[model samples]
Target: MMALQATLQHHPLLRATLRSGWRERWSFSGDMLPALRWREGETGGLLPQAEEIDLRREAGLKVYVVQDRSTVDVTFQFHHACCDGAGIDRFTDDLMVHYAGLREFGKSYKFVPTVDPNRLAVRGAYGLSFFRTLKRLPGQLVGLMGAAQFWGRQPIPLLAHQARDRCTKSTKAYPALTSFLLDPSQTLALRKAANHRNVTVHELLVCEFFCALWDWQKLYGQYSERHWTRMMIPINLRDASYRSLPALNYVSSIFLDRRGDQGGDRDQLLKGIRAEMEVIKRFQLRYTFLFVLNILNGMPWALKRSVQQDTCKTSVIFSSAGKTTRRCPLPRRDGFLHVADLVLRDIDGLAPLRPYNCVTMFTLEYANRLKLNLHYDAEFVSEKQSDVLMDLFVAGLNQVADTAGTQL
Candidate 1:
């Protein structure tokens, strides 16, 4: 099932690279290796991972390329083992320089990889000194043992066929469409809006996403759902020692989920999310190490899956990007746009280890407002339902932007 679909998604380009003598680089990043399968009764199939990229190996460097035909009609996937947004951005910058030289003069540079999870100490190894200082080991509990505070889960469920929304570009634009993009001009406005709130771009983006969620839910009358959706935001881990390793998904997503389905008011939700980002960004390194500890626990299969899901549920997400460094150049300043390829899933293998009804929302980069790409399960949702969810995001963003302006 998932296996065959993975094959259809088989990037012939990647296969060619492998045949040309490529060696795969592995790391702590979530690698995309999924088994493709048709949900219960769907036509187009789904992958056993997130829907972000199609990374394949041919030599020392693993290539991550877009599966979509063009920028206008966007649909992409990712390998969870690769670096998250920021990490990949850095890798691409270096890669583009290398590629530019190669394409221009038939010469190429070899990728010198770095960092191996197999060798690193448990992330955030609170040295023995800290442990000895504690009156009692806190991780110990009722048969459960000590548990780190971070709930790190990456859930991969097989969603029912009815839940997915099939989206494709209609050459002639469709009505009720939600635009998504990373236009430089619009992004500047978003940053300015956040500044007015005394918040950073990332914080403002997080709040905007929640507002999108709230709006989508309200549009579909899902605002009263008993369960609150969990979001996962990946944080890149970089250090001098990591320079030797080939960059992979060297990131850990912090979870932002409601424990008891306690939703917040529009203003409150925005503030709460901003607060979480403020605190997490300040101590992101500690959070990454805490995640590394769980991976080392060596738990059984049941617990491993549970832990994985718990770790990821807090991070799955997609949104826009705007510059905080006001000095950043405009897209037109360089002719080509600094396009953002926002991804939310692993798109390589067809392993049953994928989560169900996974919803990845992407805002399309456009000249004006943006578009939203909701890559979700066809079984658990429909195209209309997906659009409704996006509507929520739209309403939320506009509402918050409006209020933030009023407050300022």
Candidate 2:
């Protein structure tokens, strides 16, 4: 672990995020301190929050190793201000390569990864226009107001109210988190199901998620004949044409609108999801705001706050890191050390202070296993409630798998 720390401490990506301080932009100044340590437990909360490296003063990443009776787990905590999941992927890949060289080759390894600054602008939809910016301003303003109302007033949405009687009250936001993991075999089944339906795994997950929400509402709350829900799906900009850059915030989120009034049919649901996703993938939603974000790497906090506030109208934010085809080079077992799990915690930003008004789901494939990590405001979703939703979600996926070729 000591050797691992030494290696990561020098990584260019980690160092860039660490040494840079945030204001309006990242400025290089203080040296960063990225740590590595061991704990005793199979399952435990990551490093204590009280005494530790300060993100503003130190590095935005920290690593914790836990030793259980039969397995070892590695936990990575990252400040959202510095990096996103894609950034984490790059770091993980680098870490694995470095570790493999140290353990297998017995050499002090080092390498730096470079990022293309003009990547976003090269996407063909990034040219700037004063008239376009001016036109979007009013819409952005409306979005901000809508967010404030959704988060503060907690009023029923115009479309939602027409469907059924629902309760809207502000509750203390607590951290209620959960995970739903599919073993390798189950993950394979899910892929096969998606292929059968002629849709991507992400579309399948979204369909099931919406179905699960509908099921939950029918079982626990108001049952609407026709309910309108909103979710934000972030698109990764580092694909194909644009090289994967080691930069944070290189993502743009597109909002998805779902209206489920028809009788719950898995085929219909999956079909709708696939259609919407296709539209989203095509034209790239005009690559909205990509050019703007690229220009402002570390957007001013006030601007971020304004944008985030405007997005409170969404019921959830669902992001899928897709699949990692490149295998992790870090040895799973190297005499005395048996890597059991690689856990990624999503406590980015000052989560408790201004918690997400809606639940957030982050899905990814690691070590060939599909997994989901859910983050919800505890006041809105208790532990029991979260369990119910997750159980339904898993069941929904399996149901699709069971009917793969026969159904949609």
Candidate 3:
């Protein structure tokens, strides 16, 4: 507990609180760290759901520790306005390192605090000059127009039955989570399959997700040639220069729009995604989203009104948090990461759910194993439907792995 608290003191953003009014700002204080919440039991088993954090009155971060006999599970929940997935990973790495140092070296271990923690702010992180942003404005405008046209047509939700009307009446957002894991062998096969096709594992995963969604929706007779499947892929904007920055929101997204007819064939869909992703990377088109955000930042009323009237622009938000182990300072014992006496068995977290964008997919690779976490708004999607969708996704990946083995 001491190490954890000490670690939080080093990151300014962790202790900051959100202050809203005409203009919102983050207020930081030395004595504002949230007390750690600890529980005893098997966190993996069925249990009563915890209440959601109210960011307006509390800190933007929450830490919970669950200890069950010999196993310990730690979960961190952060408001999206304060941090991104990469930021969470970075913070976890620091926490483990702190705990390990305190346990091993005891009194001799001295902690080093982050220098100029205020620099972690998203300001100037996009690396876009005023002139450059102006140059990109036209292209971004065109893309927004294209997105508006698609949204005007009303893209179908992942589930066949719509619950937006019923869900809107509820004051609280009830987000539910479900997850599955691929063993090292299965993960290896998937990687090999990606290599055989000259595509990245990330690209392959996206393609498989699209295919799985198509198949799952077809079961409910939701498949239509006119319907479009829009997905938002978050792109981390942190380059080598911003690598040392603390956990914060330094991410943008690239939208992928595909018609039902376009995603019917797996190979063709993969080909199209690969080419589109290449173009997005080659031209650094991810900055286009950031440019629009910068413009909105200056107009507070416009941003507020947009959020209040926000509709689900995309079918799903998919984030691939690749290889978390690489950034960790702690050593692995047996097959799991160990911090002092605690063995880290698993790491799973949910992406935030929005009004219409109820379903979000988060993927993380740890200990050479790939884990997929599905988070959905309970008001929007039922628990049974979430399970079926996850099953289809896993089945799609297993099919790819099996095909790879046959080729071998």
Candidate 4:
């Protein structure tokens, strides 16, 4: 396809990977850089065929241009070593601009590479001082301990055991990932609701997630008034120097503490979460986690693995990439390629090296359309239950949206 050709030819990362490979094995040591490998496949010219991309290959990054009924669907799968969501966003932006220029101008334009060696935060001024990080380690440890205890009390023992049994019976590392596209009107209504309630859409969605989870627990007779759940939310850390640069994995996460009883008052819960996020942002607590990660980067492999295992306590990874106003190179007001829909989906079970429980939810807004992607561990979240959970999540969104006319 012309779009595919233009994307592959212009984007530096894609072009370099096409010429090189994408198997940038993750190492704390700076010995191995990222590479890419390409594969060309036909999907029988149908829908949802992009799911056929084999993520198990050692390439670490896979790009597929699937031929659908009307248009070409370009799907990308990359290892975290290549980049975090923010990095990937930048790469896709370049790809789109390249495609647009070719479509509109019929010529290849000069591409600006956003990669920066100085933008590496581990050794940069943007990162916190080691000594200061060490000083705060005790407090951080206390906070983490409290969060762990809170989460431990939440997941129902019987439910977890049953889910584990179901998962053990199945050999799949991941469940059937699902994608939902919200129309422009729906996205706008949700935004209006979020603004009216004085909460970021991120917090609003997070609250809805917990509400869904709580509903499931109660419906399944597993909910306890004394229990609470913690969801880990990734926070972007692109500061002044690196904000413009195309970098990889510049991210940290904070666990949101949701008490079981707080699910009743959605507005109140949103306010509390917004306030907590504000405090976290104002105090730069996310950099503390980055500092800890930088420390792990220098440790022995065994020690780093041990630390990661010990710290992996969250119930789910919730990522809302916010919104992007960037459009294609061609003249289009609100979308890519004028009429095509832009949807972003994560290829689950790619990184076998750092395996973790997968009840992950990702959301993003592009050209006023909001898309939701849910990837769950088949072992932990059963297929039937996954559908039910997604339903509850959507229902919760409507419930919150109903408050659009009400003040916080």
Which is the leading candidate under lDDT? 3
Supply candidate 2's per-residue lDDT for 398. 70
Please report how far candidate 1 places residue 152 from its true position, in Å: 13
Cα lDDT for residue 123, model 3? 53
Question: Distance from true position, residue 297, model 3, in Å?
Answer: 4.4
Q: Report the poorest 10 consecutive residues by lDDT, candidate 4.
A: 345-354
lDDT assessment of candidate 2: 0.56
By descending lDDT, how would the candidates be arranged? Answer: 3, 4, 2, 1
lDDT of candidate 4 over 170-240, digit per residue (tens): 45643356566677778878888888877778888888888888887788786866654667778887766
lDDT of 2 by residue, 1-408 (tens): 544555444433354433343333343433545665667876555334322335545665677677778555566766666566676666666565555556654655544433443443333343335685566555554444434443453322211222211233344433456787676677778889888879889988988887777776677664565556666677775665444455354566666566656436778877877776665454344254443454444665745655545233555678877764243434442211222233332222212112333457778775557877776555556778778778878877778878643221
Cα RMSDs of all predictions?
A: 10.8, 7.7, 3.1, 6.5
Query: Which residue pairs collide in model 2, if any?
Result: none
For model 2, what is the error of residue 63's alpha carbon versus the real structure, in angstroms, after optimal superposition?
Answer: 2.5
Q: Runs in model 2 with CA error above 4 Å?
A: 1-23, 35-37, 42-55, 68-70, 107-175, 222-227, 241-244, 262-265, 289-305, 308-311, 325-358, 404-408
Residue 366 of model 4 has an lDDT of 72
Candidate 3's residue-wise lDDT over 239-337, tens digit each? 776767787787889888888787668889899999988877756678767655667778957666665554556788899889885767667865588
**Candidate 1 on 1-408: residue-level lDDT in tens?**
222122212122212222223434322223333323222332223322333233443212232222333222111233444334333333333333333434444434343322243333433332333644242233222112112344333222222222212243222212112233434554556657777777776666666665555545565455544444556554445455554333244554455654213445545765787776665555333244343446465554644556444223332365332221122122322333342332221111111112433456544332333334556544445667766666655555555456434211
Q: Select the stronger candidate by TM-score from 2 and 3.
A: 3
